[model samples]
Target: MVSLAPYVLKRPWLTKMLTPAANWYASASGYRQLGLRYDDLLEEENEAVQIALKRLSAKEAYERVYRIRRSVQCSYTHKLLPKDQWTKPEEDVPYLRSILAQVEAELAEKDALDSMTVIKKH
Candidate 1:
């Protein structure tokens, strides 16, 4: 659970310095051109991701699958989405990351509670 985001965010200078480079990296990664959100690239084999996907609204789930399938089709055909169809930076939100964070937090809380010892004085 050691995330560098908090550390980077805490330093405004660092955030300012890295924002453009991060955006450039994201754009260069080409998922956007394939009409895929950053979250769509996340590994689906993990329990946390599975729980997160399950928590998504039906529409969101359907859209996620559509994006993945479309991206796969694009890969098969060796084509990128049309320029107009590329995912806009504004539209590329961390939908799954927030839910995954919540699920992980709940799991951690459960683990903590499960390991707790109770003592009673009569």
Candidate 2:
């Protein structure tokens, strides 16, 4: 609830004239790097990501989304898909059809996640 400046100022060891001010400013700057306000700075990053159900083009937007997801190890490739094999496993039509079903299921799950993320927040 308290701002960084006052908190830093209260600690004598952390304060020496403008040093506390500078330190607080630097700390706040780091929060800005994380796209946070100083007062809301310590809140979970996931808290903000549940903003809204923005529309997206499938392939290109998907690439961007997965890049960020992979950056955070939250993508299917990071979680479920393996390094050696992705897409339909090397199998006959029935096997491939089952794999396609699983893929569709995964895609639907991802969509449901993205859609429902904002429900509570909204």
Compared with the true structure, the alpha-carbon lDDT of candidate 2 equals 0.41
Q: At residue 77, give the lDDT of candidate 2.
A: 37
TM-scores of all candidate predictions against the true structure: 0.88, 0.21
- Model 2: worst 10 consecutive residues (lDDT sum): 87-96
lDDT by residue (57-107, candidate 2, tens digit) is 356345545434443453333453343322222211121233334555667
Please write out the lDDT profile of model 1 over residues 11-56, one tens digit for every residue: 9999999999999999999999999999999999988889999999
What TM-score should be assigned to candidate 2? 0.21
Model 2 residue runs over 4 Å out of place are: 1-93, 119-122
